[model samples]
Every structure is written in C-alpha cells, then in structure tokens.
Target chain A: MNQKTNISQIAVVGTGVIGAGWIARCLAHGIQVIATDPAPDAEANLRKSLQQAWPSLEKTGISPGTSPEDLIFETDMAKAVEKADLIQENVPEVLELKHQVLGAISQACRKDAIIASSTSGITPSVLQQGCHCPERLLVAHPFNPVYLLPLVELVAGEKTEPAVLTRAESFYKEIGMKPLIVRREVEGHVADRLMEALWREALHIVNEDIATTEEIDAAIIYGAGLRWAQMGPFLTFHMAGGEAGMRHMLKQFGPALKLPWTKLEAPELTEDLKEKVINGCETHAGNKSVTALAAKRDEFLVEVLQLAEKYWPEPQSIMKK
Target chain B: MNQKTNISQIAVVGTGVIGAGWIARCLAHGIQVIATDPAPDAEANLRKSLQQAWPSLEKTGISPGTSPEDLIFETDMAKAVEKADLIQENVPEVLELKHQVLGAISQACRKDAIIASSTSGITPSVLQQGCHCPERLLVAHPFNPVYLLPLVELVAGEKTEPAVLTRAESFYKEIGMKPLIVRREVEGHVADRLMEALWREALHIVNEDIATTEEIDAAIIYGAGLRWAQMGPFLTFHMAGGEAGMRHMLKQFGPALKLPWTKLEAPELTEDLKEKVINGCETHAGNKSVTALAAKRDEFLVEVLQLAEKYWPEPQSIMKK
Candidate 1:
C-alpha cells in the first residue's frame, strides 16, 4: 500500500521499551522520527533508552549522518502523525486499546502513509478494526533492542493491499532490516509459536522438578543454542544427517517424535514451581543483574551479527555502508 | 572411578565424524590420541577430517605442543587402548555394536580408565549392558564440530559410580569442555531431547508444505535463534517479561501453548515433502555446497565460542590460554 511513498518521517506511538528501541533504530538509520506516548515520563525514558542503546547500536553500524537529535516527541496522537510517512504503533497488547489507537492514527495520516503495529502475537486483521483506511494497516513486528537485530516480520491483514505489503517490505529493507513475510496469520506468528513450543517444554522441565532453571539454560547455552544462532532446526538437522541431509535424518529418527518430551499444553505454574524457578534464576544470576545480563547479551549479539553479515552479506546493510 | 587416572593417552574407537571430532578436540588440547576403526577407508577419512578440523580448532585455541602428527590410528581396538587412560567410543548407534565395543574397550583398558560413549540418544544403561566394569562408563555427548562447541553432557547409568561422573566432569573441563552433569539419565539425555523436539517441529513444517526450508530457516536464524545464542528459553522469556520475570510471562500468555502451531506428531515425510525439502535446501544453499556451509558454520562457530569464552571465561579454555 505504501510501496511508493517515501517513509522519510516516521511516527512511533507508545514509548515503552519496544517503542524506544524502534526510535533508536530509526534514528540510527537517519530517519526523522516523531514519537507520541501518553505516559507522563515517556519522553525522558525514550531519551535514556537512546543513550543506553547508542554504544551497541554503533557497533551494529549506523548510516552516515545518523544522530539522536533528529528525534522529537509529542503527547497528542493526531499531532504525532500529522506529517508521518509511516506510523508504528507499539501500545500494550490489549486488543480494544490497539483498535482504538490504530483507528485514531489512521484518521491523522495521509492516504499513502503506511501504518504498522509491532504486536508480537496479535494478527494484523484484528488491529485494522474501525480504522479509517484499513488497506494501509499491517504488522511489522521486531525483536527487543530492535536496532541490533536485522529481523522484522511483516504480516498483512485481510483488508491490506498486496502493494502496501511490498512497499513496507522494500522500505524496511531500505532501512537495513531483514523483512520476513509471514505466509499466514497465526496467534504467535511463526517464530513466536516455535519459541512458545520450546518455552512450554522448558516450563514442563522445570515444573516436573526434573531440572532447575540453571540446568535448562546450560542445556541450551552450551549446546543447541549455538547452532540455532546461525541456522534453524530444519537446516541444522539437514547438516546433522551428514552428507545425505534432512531426508536421511527424517528416516533415521522420525520415530522419536512420539516421545513425551514436549507438553502440548503448558503445565500449571504452581507456586512451588514458581519458587524453584525464581531461586534457580537468582542463583544463576549470581552477581549480574538482569540489566547487566541484557547488556552482555546485546554486546555479544552485535559481535555475532557482525560476524554473520561477513559470511552472508545483505544488500541493504551494504547500501547503508 | 577415573578421578585420578592420568588421561595423557586417549583411545578413540570408531573414527567416524563424531570420533574424528573427538580426536581433533583431544589432539588440539595436547592429549596423545590413538584411534581405531574397522572400515577400510576409515583411516583416510579420519586423516582428512583432522586436516579439515585443524584450522578451525586452531582458531578455537590449542595448547603449547599440540600437533596433528600426535594423532595415531590403529586397526585393532585392543592395541588402540593398550596405554589409554580414557577411551571415547563413537561406534554406530546400534545397541549391540556399542555393547560389544564398549565391553571390549573395558577389557583392554586399566580398571581406573574411564570409557565414554558418544551415543546421541541411547542410554548409558543400555550401552553398559554387557560391559566388563560398567562403573567406569558414562555418556559424554558433544555436538558437531566438537572442537568448538564447549558443551559436553555427561550422563551416568545405574552402574556408573558417582565419583566417576565427577572425575569425567573434571577431565572434560581439563580438556576445555563445559561438562554438564546430567542429574538423571533419560532417553536422548537432556540437550538432545530439546533439540529433537525442535527437530521434529521443523520436520512437520516441511512436511505440511507450510513453509520452505529457507523460510523456516529465516524464521529461526533471524528470530528466536538470536536469543538462544547466549540464553535458553527460560532466561529469554524471563527477560521478555520485563521486571516481574518468568512469572509475569507465564501469567500473561501461558494459555497459548494449546495452539495448533506445533504438531505433536511429525507429519509423514512423504516423497513430495522430501523432494521439496531437498530442493528447498538446495535453493537456500544457493551456490554453496553442504561442505562449504559446514566450513563457514565452523569458522563462525569458532568466533562465537571464543566470544562466549570471553564473557563466561571457562577455566578449561582459560587454562590453555
């Protein structure tokens, strides 16, 4: 829908962590950003986040002339998107609130302006309800610390135009993001669903008292986690099968699928299990706070990402350089 | 059992990929290695793998006097373990073969020697069915490119001495491995089961034709895969939940586990799906061969592992440094 419209000026609604991350990413790409949030301290928080994210984001590589000074904030929703080429809504997950906010933003934006939601699980169709121009609404979900990660999943609603999807895809790519066009709408989208499956299994492991949080983390961090960083389960298995690839792997170990390793439904998060999980996390946290761990994670992530780009260079990233 | 045994000389039975990997890792760590295999081309393949692995292993870091020339392969298992203080058996996954080979290795080695089976899924209890001294036997599973990945899951069987587990842990650590002492022995051990679950889900996605190999790979490499590089799902979601941690996440969306996103039973890998998967992989492979991808994976894995060591700073790896 917005394939041809140049998204030079972008409006980001909701200055939560996700929204602040978006602002940092956009600013790093040299985009003029206008952000809006109702929270009393939203502007200050956004500024703090940009400062915190600057060091790692620089490591991720920024466009020439990128600066934090280009960012501006407004409290009024209509005033925020008054001149926006694109609007990225990052409000809470409540469906009704999202619908109202999206509808209001649509009323403020121009006909060609693309409006996207950063909803992790909610479908784009639901977000389009009561919007003035439903054809321009879509989902452009991204991970945390959005400036570092190259992925951005774009999901199109039923009322959305195919042209708009293409436009959004091109725009996202132009900004140095890898846009994964999810084939169909699902509760958690593709990646989150797969993650949820693993998450449920992890919960089952801890809930059953079979292993602690630390053991589960070790089971991944020291092993499979390393592999997944570069390849998915499919290609990974294809490699694991040796020269023959995925077919050989399927035939050899297909029967193991029947094993009761994963829980289809999540086990109840009982008080005891919660306590054990909390204690386990505290033990593993050691002297590092969550913030420290997150910073370390981000630092290594930038290194890993830079390493990835070396082997598999992307055109968009190259364009920025 | 082998707590005090001087593991200067190591016997590697069955010089397949896993065995060659173990040999490469051991030799790089400056351990004297003797390997045995019955296959006519085993020696040639092992030599080639050792040559292929050295460059990356060197990047992983090596001891003062480590060299490929220190590796010796024998045709007879008894001669191979003649002076070995540690024997790593990597025979095929066949239970009967493992029983025979492990039993024979135990008979040849000293009573204090530790025998480790590199069985991916088979239980140590089953592998130790007819062993001479099962007390010194346990499972020490490592991922592919074993020279780089720091993880080594050590699982104990019924007859395995608790002290032997501790000894194996220390020995593995001495060799620059992060040995995870599996609290209890189960099928596929701990990491493999988690990997298998993801593997099965991947197979299902491919079988249903929901997404191509490249898409599924994209879904992972760009998304959940990033989080996995440093922390497992428990820790990842704990961070995702903001300040309240895992409890907040569990309470927020624990019910999404019952969604139809993941198939409990892997869809039958029909001929069509196999062709598509192979074709998809070929497409994703682009102009590169599996061998090429593997080499690149290893190169990047070495970098990732090195970065991980910098943060975690494992004693074994640091000892070599």
Candidate 2:
C-alpha cells in the first residue's frame, strides 16, 4: 500500500498560496519541482512562502535531498511543464482562466503526465473539456496548508483513463496523502460541501446576529470541533448512538431532522435513507462496538482537549469583547 | 474569571446518557450530586456509564475529595431537586415531557435554585412557559460525552433574570467549560445549528450516492477536521486569506457563495455581511498577522496529524472496501 509514486518530477502551475503549498509538500517528499506563474513577483513570493513553510515541513520530516532553493521558477508555462511527470494547476477558480491555463499545460506536458487541478468547486469533467488529452486530466483537490493536510479528493473526468486515477492515487499517497476518490462529479466535491454547508449556516448565524463570529468560532473550538478532529459526523454519531450504534441514533434524533434546526432542509428520513445511514455507520465501525469505539474517542478527546487549550487563541470573553 | 461556582450541591434529573455525563463531570469537579430517574434500570445504567468515564476523567484530573461513589441516586424527582443548589435536567427532547417534568421540578425545588434544561432543539423560553419560578430556568446545553467537551451554550428565557444567566455562566466556567452566552434564542442554539447543517448536507451526499460513510469520514479526519480542533471556520479562512486576512478571502472566494455548492442556500454576501465577517475575523486575530497565525496553525496541524494518524480508525481504502 505504501508503494512509491513513479512520478519523480512535477511542475506546479501557479505560485499562489495553494501552489506554494504544493511546492513545499513535494519538496519535503524529495520530489523535484518546476513552478510557473505569470504574476510579476510570483517567484519571489513563492520563495518567501517556501521559506516560511520549510521549518514546519522539516518538523514533519523533509526528504533526503530536497531544499526550497532547488525549485525552478519558469515564467513560460510550456517550458516549465514540458518535462515533468505531473502538472498541478492551482490558478484562481474561474472556469475560463482554468480552461485557458489547463489548455496551455496539456499541450506542453508529456502525454502521459497527470494534469491535476486544485479547484475546490469545479468538476474534473468540466475542467477536462478542452484539454489536449483529456484522459490524463483529473481533479486532485487538497485542503489549505496543503503541505500538512493529507486529504486529496481524486475525481476522474468523463474522458479520464482509469489508470490515470490509479497512478494519481499512488503518487499522492507517496507524497503523504489520503486520496478520497469521489464516485460522482458535483460542485464542492465531498469535504467542501460539508464545509460549505457549515460555513453558510455560520454566515446566517452571523447575519441574524445570534452570535458573533468569535463566539461561533468558540462554539466549534470548544465542542464539536474537538471531536471532528478525530471523527466525521457519521462515526461520531455512531458512537453517540450507544450500544445499538447508528440504529439507535437515527431512531432518537431522526425526527429532529424535520425540525427547523438549520436553514438547510434535510432529506426525508425514509426507511431506505435510515437503513443506508445505519448500515454505513455499522460497516464503518467494523469489529468495534459502540462502547469500544467511544472509549477510543474519549481517549483521543482527552489528549486533543489539551492540545486545543494550548493552540486555540484566547477567545474574547464570550460576548464581552 | 475562574471563580469557584457557588453551586456546591447539584441535582441531575433523568439519568440517561446526558444525565450520567453531568454526574461524571460534577463528581470530577468535586460537587455533591443527587441524581434521579424513574426508569427501572436507570441507576444501574448511570453507574456503568460513570465507571466507564471515570478513568478518562481521572486523566483530566479529578477533584481530591469527590469520587463517583459519592453520588446518590433517588427515584423520586422531588427529593432530587429539593435540597440542591442547582438542578440540571437531561430528559428526552419532547416538549410536553419537558414542560411536565420542568413544571414539577420548578415547584418542588428550592425557590432560589437554578434550573437548567439540556434541550438541544427547544429554546429555554418555551421550556419555561408553565414552570413555577420560570425566572430560574434557562437552557444549558452540553455536547455528548459532556464530561470531556468543554462547550456549553447558555441561553436565557424571556422571563429569566439576567442575574441567573450570570450565575450560570460562572458555574459552567467553574466546571472547566467554555460557556458561550447565546444572545438570541433559536432552534439548536449555535453549535448544533452549525452541526445540523453539516449533518444534513452529509446525509444528502450519502443519499445521492456521492460517497460512502467511510470515505466521507476520511474527507474530514485528514483535512478540515484537523484544523478545526484549534481554529474554527472564520479564523481558518482568515489565515487562508494570506497577508490581508479575511478581507482578501472575501474578495477572492465570495462569489462562490452564490454558486449551488451545498444543499443549503447561502445568504447574499451583502457588503454589510462582508464587513461584519471581516471585522469579526480581524478582531479575533488581534495582533497576529496571517503568516503568524498560519505558522501557529501549521505547528498545531503537525502535532494533531500525528495524533489523528494514531487514533483515526484505519479507513477503508478510498472507494474500495
């Protein structure tokens, strides 16, 4: 499972925050990188960003021979991407701009080179529309601070080769990532949809003046946020379901789904939806009972609580700030 | 102000998961507890929960003089509330049942004793409608495994005295909790509203067959969840905005708010809302620059990623079981 990525050299197309992040991560993994950006000061900015991120990357253990100074900054996109095995495009999230940059990169890069987009919203199918060889294009969206967070959602375009996805998965894993292969193409993908939902609700909370942004932040940092660090909503609720797991939880809180708890209208809690949710959780829990899973959660929470106390900024005294 | 709560002796009504949690937390804080529930096996179940939680509580440090053995169980609600300084109710989340139980406890308890309901959906205003001494009742909702999570959203009713909310705040703070004083009463309070929004969207994802429960959980455990433990969404985005902070972020990604990203509809990103969010984050960031904050965030992520790797269950491979 820990097989090395055959991809030894890559080109990072764009030198913004996300592009710099990819450079830092790949450099830390000892992969050679050529980064290209059209902005006048992109090279200096990316260099500075790498300098800032290097210490942290080192703490996470940098690869043997890679250094920030080893990066190549090319003003010409074609020249930069020509020889690399993969080209990670992190340009701004506009469709026209992405199509334009991607079109140029696809023409220049090797035919077998993987063209991965860091787009948070656009689908890979949409992104691969006008590419030279669309079969090699895929969406490999990583979270912010890409040097650290391990998730990289891998979504294949309609024209993408299955082998391309398989290669991308191994390459991403080789660079210390957990690639979640999205089964369907949708706006915001999986993680961002969940995040955007919470973000929208949070914005509404702020709009209505129910709580300040600080208080809302405190609301998360102190409670659900701590647990989220270890488990997603499904597994967390599975443990909360007690001995019966999701079966009991859906029964108990299922009705509340209809309540005007959030502005987001919930799906009908039909028997089919209920079984899918329950079965999903039961399967995710595996050999562990709810109590056993809960014990592990509690142990994780105890340590994370301490870590949070140390890192979470001193919140403005409730509403008193 | 870490003032010791004036609440020394407390009553826990309805010895279910939440009530037992209250008992465990109280005992750990050295408070005297008398818990009451009419169910046949309530006491036995509560005792078992306490035993399971005690080891974790001990790791968080227990008050010297108090232990789980000091708890008293009474089947009669009147006897439970009569002598205690404060009574924490954790009954099932049914309106009529809450009104009936609260009506009874408000009448039987000491006139000066504070009554707090752990209702996740119903507001305190509705819960106090028919209760005797309604001014003493407020909503003090705690998350699951309440013994560990530090957040408690405190909402006061229309008839409740401001002084009672003041006391409740100090009391929850005294118990090693972060009490978020919700300014406006609404369904699900603050945190749960955010959580419910995410949960609903997650269900939609599963219903649409976008991803499995395991992949969804992996989406979070590896990425946003790690950051969430230390910084909530506002500050997280704040740092993502780079040098200009949230100000720059809104300019960059605010248009996406209008896109159909999540099932939930986002509020119009009006200029007023923009300033409020930007101001909120800027105030929260205080003297730190975005780089400084990102550095802190990176350091925390490095450690938390290690913690998560150790604790997060082995996720099933991407799309394959």
Give one digit per residue, the lDDT tens place, for model 1 in A4-103: 4477889999988789889998888878899999999989988977886776666556887878777898899999998888899999877889989988
Q: Comparing only chain A of model 1 with the true chain A, what is the TM-score?
A: 0.81
- Per-residue accuracy of model 2 over A1-321 as CA lDDT, tens digit each: 124557989999988999999999998888889999989999999999999999989988888877999998989989999999999999999999999999999999997799999999999989988688899999999999999998899999899999999899989988988889999999999999999999999999999999999989989888888998788889999877789989999989999998999999999988888888999888888888888888999999999887777887755544331
DockQ metric for all predictions: 0.19, 0.71
Candidates' chain B TM-scores in the order shown: 0.81, 0.97
Candidate 1 RMSD to the real structure: 14.4
Stretches of candidate 2 above 4 Å error?
Answer: A1-4, A315-321, B1-4, B315-321
Clashing pairs in 2: none
Give TM-scores for every candidate, taking all chains together and pairing residue i with residue i. 0.79, 0.98
Interface RMSD of each: 14.7, 2.1
Provide the lowest-lDDT 10-residue window in model 1 chain A. Answer: A312-321
lDDT of each: 0.70, 0.90
